[model samples]
Target: MSILIFSLILLVGAYAAGLLGSLTGLGGGVVVIPLLTLVFHVDIRYAIGAALLASIANSSGAATAYIKEGITNVRLGMFLEIATTAGAVGGALIAVFTPVNTIAILFGLVLIFSALMTIRKKNEHAEQTGSKWSYVLKLNSTYPTANGEVAYKLKNIGGGFSIMLLAGVLSGLLGIGSGALKVLAMDGAMRIPFKVSTTTSNFMIGVTAAASAVVYLQRGYIDPGIAFPVVLGVLGGAFTGARLLTIMNPRTLRIIFCIAISFVALEMIYNGFNHQF
Candidate 1:
């Protein structure tokens, strides 16, 4: 009975994660991490590990469609993978040695900061200007939008890459899907369009997760009992979210996202300060 109940919870959580992830392009980690940690009372470390696996599942399942549609810049994703993968490895290694309390506090603080950042920004549909590195790397690309195909140039390749490294490390250390930071680095720093940034970020996420997943596996964090239901539910939810994307308004999604992220951030902070392993 206990096992059955847990399975039901896992499915529900994963389903919600996938649905929200697809709708917002934030990926499943944003939803899974918090759900696992706050609702299930799972340890943060294990929660991150499970989240990483779910990320891979989410990316693999969704990226194909984006790629087929030619909205994902495979080349740009490949180039950035060099940095993010390396960073993931480094971050995972650090995770093995870091104290649990420290990890918890850091993770909480970062999530809060990320949430705040999202809330502060107003949605701007204008194309952002690319930086010098973008010109050098020729990271610019185009994608089909409702209006038509829109072309965008990359900006700040170096800055974006540098940030990716940091993002990778955080992903490794914290067990996040790291999609938000990757998007910020590519879209915010590099001035890529949101669609391009999201698709490319999705393309790169699997590699980042894979880089650290092996380490987690070796450390005995990849519990099949937990991972199975979580992955299945998230995948289902993601599919649903993707389908709903066509009908949902972007502004409404953003507002919901802001509220959700902020809530997760606060939960992390409070848990970090008060909870014990």
Candidate 2:
């Protein structure tokens, strides 16, 4: 492809990725990497770097609206950041020596799992009985609803933190936001409300991606030319998605995410096994 045409394709692709990611709380990197590797024939390392940067932009752009809407738990996100940052650092270090095919295969599996999890009904109004850690750490919180402020409580602090570490590792290793895992930790493990979990996950992903992005930058994985279009397009899309969050039904977005993720997962696995990527 010519330079202008390639840039246009990247821009459109990144925009779609960011829109779906922000809307579904899955993060744009999941879509970004597959498109880059499978469609554009980009190298995984550079694609990952571009995806991470775009993820940072998407998360930050969408988080402003989510935070203002009172769905994001800032304190909860900060607490989880401690574990995520540490894991991200470790994962980034390991990514340097890991085989490309291994990364692709793992990415495929993660994509499939996330897709299934996305379509599952979330228990948003589970009991508010707080765990000891939830009480101590103030993980129990409330978010505004149409009826009123809906209260929720954290369940498994240890489990949530452990899962967050894994999320961070995947983010760093694959250069994606890994927001699906983050949401799973909060919504599934801690039993946070679906909206709160997604918004908080979006809030936390920016910090997580940034920490790992530094490692990629130092290692020379990031390229300015590729990052420009991806970052701009993803950021714009995220802003648009955030504006639409209150009006749109999340189930609709989840269905869309499931279909897209399923395709990407299959393609990633095919590429990994055949060494086509």
Find the candidate with the highest lDDT and give its number: 2
Model 2 C-alpha lDDT per residue in residues 147-199, reported as the tens digit of each score: 98888888999999999999999889988778789988998888888889888
User: Per-residue lDDT of 35-130 in model 1, one digit per residue for the tens?
Assistant: 887788888778887888988988888888888889898888999898888999999998979877677778767766565544445323535576
User: Candidate 2, 116: how far from true, in Å?
Assistant: 1.4
TM-score against truth, every candidate: 0.89, 0.93
Any idea how many clashes model 2 has?
Answer: 0
Candidate 2 — which residues are off by over 4 angstroms?
Answer: 243-247, 250-253
Each model's lDDT: 0.79, 0.85
What residue runs in model 1 are displaced by over 4 Å at the alpha carbon? Answer: 116-136, 146-148
Pairs that collide, model 1: 14-233, 14-234, 15-233, 18-237, 18-238, 19-237, 19-238, 130-155, 131-155, 131-156
